[model samples]
Target: MPGSLHNWYSLSWLDMLAERQSVLSGRIELKRLARLRDMLHAHDGSVTVNLRFGKRDGAWVIVNLECEATLALLCQRCLEPMLHTVAARVELGLVESASMASRLPEDYEPVVLEGDRLMPARLIEDELIVSLPLMPKHAHTSECGSLVRRRDESTGEAWTLDCAPPTSH
Candidate 1:
């Protein structure tokens, strides 16, 4: 209880935290989450993480995580940096083994403990990764710097700037 909740804890230790209804709430630097930072163009910001450990339906061991962050990512459409905001909420069912994962309810994502320890930081990072957009881009074409629309009257062909390279006219 005295230590930081982000630190690794034994799977068995979770029960005690759940019993006390422990909550871990803080801001985590993006650089600390290496995998997540690798996916972004700029990792200078921090994410707000709020985790609550408890039992659900009086039988299921669950941890609820809520995360919010603003990340700088390369726009797939224009090849420029764009701000992407992420707000993620995940309900994870804690299980000791992979076999137990299937037992979790549909509403809960199963998090199987590796060996005897659980890494809360890794869990938070994984959740944030999945919450990211598959293809990051500005909402409107006018917002992009390199987006261009070209029309060839002879062939009736129109070209729009995209992730693909432009072909010779």
Candidate 2:
């Protein structure tokens, strides 16, 4: 599935587990949902989540999700471009409802579906946003070097300064 249409299906718990654990790999494109955009920053990327559904704790259905992807973010410290890997594992309640406020635990955030079908794109987008880093930073350590500069003068003491443009005539 190359586009957003691939996510419009109601996958049964049993249907998800019938396939081999490793065979469920696919890319889901995220559409800009009004509700989601209001809750988090705008996002654009393919969601690569490994899925498995199984019975656990006697009677509940456990949906195990392992997701990995990279998202563009603005660094909080320097306000520069930064790309960070987003990895998360969560078990969600696969229930059908337009509003799941009552079904979810007091502390747990539920990803509810409007209808019987659970849209994979929306689910993944919500998960990614929830898993975002509080502060994003560039992966390369060298990128920080330019931000920190030093000068050593007469007294043999070192002084640190931020790399800023010099004042011109």
Candidate 3:
């Protein structure tokens, strides 16, 4: 059966870290991701997140998280709505102190464990936010609607402008 997460979810950080034997898999609605509102065209669809905890190197506990979703975002090239598919994988090391967090390996991102608790839903949301492209645009130049011939001031190179100039009253 498929598992789905609710709008709110909390878990014991210490226990999950110590036991290192839990797998959380669920889907969250786009509306729940308030931080992503500015970049999205509509709040309609669900994202799936799967997190598995495991012990790494006998000292630290790690979580492997996978997130998948299709977001309706305005294309930077077209200035119109387009579907952007996101599939990201992250490894997090649960750390108790800032010092320990700084010492984490390059492969893992440090997640501070505060008060022996954590909200898994919040972490998933954070991952999704970072996963988004800095400038979201369609792949093909032909698919873009707002692409127009323009000259670059810095390089003197010509390229298609992603959007048109705003009209002033």
Candidate 4:
């Protein structure tokens, strides 16, 4: 199927999809993805996934995965629940062994297939994990519920949002 959309479970069907050059698009509930759920403040949404499968360099199998999701993450600064958006795209080269993975070019991320029954959700989750910010925070200090640094442009002084004022000598 040139342009078929289906819910996929395992990479066992990967060869058939590669042969047809299929583009699979679907939504998976965030709560259902175990690894991802553990990293979120609240897994109450879904991720939109699009995977394009085909042959690369005439012989190597490749899958281009794109995932978009809005995750509820705990803001490290304010310790509050904040919405974080992730739009991750990765080009993966499938290989059966570590030796084969070593031969792949730098451009292709090697996905060593342990078995024919690999879950696509795992791959999507991996991308999401890497795309997340190291320290999640609101874009503006006004939106954050924690003490923030404020600069005085005229005096060239800095102060905390909830700190006591300086005492004049």
TM of each candidate vs. truth: 0.80, 0.55, 0.73, 0.76
Q: Which portions of model 4 miss their true places by more than 4 Å?
A: 1-12, 146-169
lDDT of 1: 0.81
Model 4 local distance difference test score: 0.78
- Give the candidate number with the greatest TM-score: 1
Q: Write the per-residue lDDT of candidate 2 for residues 109-154, one digit (tens) a residue.
A: 3446556565655666777777777777666656643333323443
- In candidate 1, the residue pairs with backbone N, CA or C atoms under 3 Å apart (3 or more residues apart, or in different chains) clash, namely none
- What TM-score, to 2 decimals, does candidate 4 have? 0.76
Model 1: how far residue 119 lies from native, Å: 1.8
Cα lDDT for residue 23, candidate 3: 84
- Per residue, candidate 3 scores C-alpha lDDT tens digits across 81-126 of 7788889888998887788887787689998865545666777778
lDDT score, candidate 3, position 76: 75
lDDT of 1 by residue, 1-169 (tens): 4236468888667887787788888888999899999998999988888889998777667899898999899889878789988898888889888887897888999998888678777887888888778998899988886334322444456654356676776
Model 4 is weakest, by summed lDDT over 10 consecutive residues, at 1-10
Pick the winner on TM-score between candidates 1 and 4.
1
Residue 117 error, candidate 1, Å: 1.8
Q: In order, what lDDT does every prediction score?
A: 0.81, 0.56, 0.73, 0.78
RMSD (Cα, Å) for all candidates, in order, is 6.9, 7.2, 7.7, 8.0
Clashes of each: 0, 0, 0, 0
